[model samples]
Target: MSPQQKALILLEKQGNFKVGSRSIPTPGTGQLLVKVYSAALNPVDYKIQVDGIFVTHYPAVLGVDIAGIVEELGEGVENFREGDKVLAHGNFYMIDQGAFQQYTLAVATFTAKIPSSQSFDSAATVPLGVDTAVAGLYGKHLGAGITPPWAKIVNDHEPKKPIVILGGSSSVGSYTIQLARLSGFYPIITTASPSNEDLVKDYGATHFFDRHLSASQLMVAINKVTDSPIRIVYDAISLPETQSVGWGLLAQNGILVLTLPALVKEDEGKGRKAVHTIGSPHLPHNNQELFRSSWGMIEKWLLEGIIQPNNREILPNGLEGIIGGLERMRMEQVSGTKLVAHPQETK
Candidate 1:
């Protein structure tokens, strides 16, 4: 294969992005070239484009999640073949390669084998969301009270406490509910709009509080579900108001895990712990192990039909579709369903 390939290029610092041909990257030692099938657009993609935090070069690629077939493998690569179907969280902060293209290269450790039954669009959504949830909940012992990796730490405690997952309708929140329930915690509760109450419950939320409810009303609903008060809170939506509510709802000595930096002023009376989580996809190194372990568990649940991927709305126009889809997401406040882009759309 030639060393040149086409890609979606983000030119300069003006946030202008376009699809164009560029050099096809060769797999260096321990790297693999993935023939891109579909890519997921994340909030980070637009955020980075506007803020320019991680873009070190002009004409950079902006996608983080990729699903497709492996086209070639570099020296010393193991555990993958040329035709293997795979999904990866392409190097997000790394400037050299990204998923928004016909072909891209990734380090071996950052990729996972996609189950044959999984569609490329569905597989594309797993890496970033799963890895973020895994790393946030598992890394630094944030989810220490929940499961085996952390079960030992909470063992012999007086009583297991309930966990509160904010924005449970979101993809990461949905997965957190499942993982929290699997870890043997009692009463995994979530907060979301009424329309998603049934959907969230099916994802392992024992109870769902309406996010639009008044704080007092919401507290009443939450209190009715658990007598001891929420002991651990995962703020999938990390707005200040939401954090305040989470902090106010938490029990003494409890911890609040947030996806974004907490902006709420800490209440002086509450002895609750505050933890800001930067999700897994952003972490450097150990990407492969985390991706494989979490995806392995997710695949099992999916195979058994115990857990469902979040509802998705497919954008069939491929690369050109992203701009309009993103605009819609921003305007409509895309709630429950993940917006997906199928790059191979027939045009």
Candidate 2:
């Protein structure tokens, strides 16, 4: 019989999450079996439970951000070995690949070594957040299609441009701000509560505004900062009001990138477009080459501080603690921090 491990299970569609037991899965070709130390929670995890949107199978384990030690390697896997500390973007669609389990399989392409300077909790906050930001900013179809920093033809002295990001404190938003800076965007304007101004600024936001400002007020504030055309507005929050503000701020022939479906209609006369993005690397619309190239650099970036992990708050009670953490996220009580659970600590 296969060995058993504890998992946070979603028993049914829109059902309650419970601590349960499941068999530890073996690694397949080019995969690694990781002993999960930390699993970070995202808003999507809670939304999946509340809305029953993604998973089709009953009795599923759901989690996407994982940080742990590789325990076994599959055939033809040469880049990683057993006992290497690593982080991976989990694929929750596969029951055994989810991070809620004590042991999960990670694809080699989506996994990276955790730098010595980082912890399991900090590394757990990176995978999904950074990948989502990458999809939104660099993906050809799902995003603004901007030239990625790693591209060969990218100019080191490219002209500076202006950008606006709503919800600068969110995991995706914060990563987007940092990538925008790397792409030579100037005056990286972002909106968030005053309490997160410093945090967002540290992530490379050059201008900060209170999110409570009306669309007109935000427009006025942004105008005073830059005269350049607002070519890209990333609505990381994607609420109706934020989408409206982003749509209104976009220039002719520009694009508005949204994490959720776009509620604002595009004006054909102005040629401004709104694009909804799916951030998963497994998705067809996400550029495969882009992620493959970028995932290779995650370790180096984290080591050099080019990318910063989200501020994380560790929850108690191991796998059981994830239930309360998801509830806090759903209630909008978790602010400016990612929630991480130690799955191996489950009893």
Best by TM-score: 2
The C-alpha stretches of model 2 lying farther than 4 A from their native spots are: 153-156
**Model 1 C-alpha lDDT per residue in residues 1-347, reported as the tens digit of each score:** 46665566778775777766677778899889888888887777776777777577776787878888999999999889999988877875554458777788877766777776778877887767766666656655444233333334545464656888889998788877877766656778889999999999988888888887765777788778778767788888877888888877777777888877767655676777777765544454434454455555655555665456667778767776776666666565788888777665624
> In model 1, where do residues sit more than 4 Å from their true spots?
1-3, 141-160, 285-301, 305-307
Question: Each model's RMSD to truth, in Å?
Answer: 3.1, 1.1
TM match of model 1 to true structure: 0.88
lDDT of each: 0.73, 0.92
Candidate 1 deviates by what RMSD?
A: 3.1
Residue pairs clashing, model 2:
none
Tens digits of lDDT, candidate 2, 1-347: 88999999999999999998899999999899999999999999999999999899989999999999999999989999989999999988989899998999998998999999999999999998899889889888889998898784656686789999999999999999999988888989999999999999999999999999998999999999999999999999999999999998889999999999989886558898888877787665568778888899999999999999999999999999999999999999988999999998887
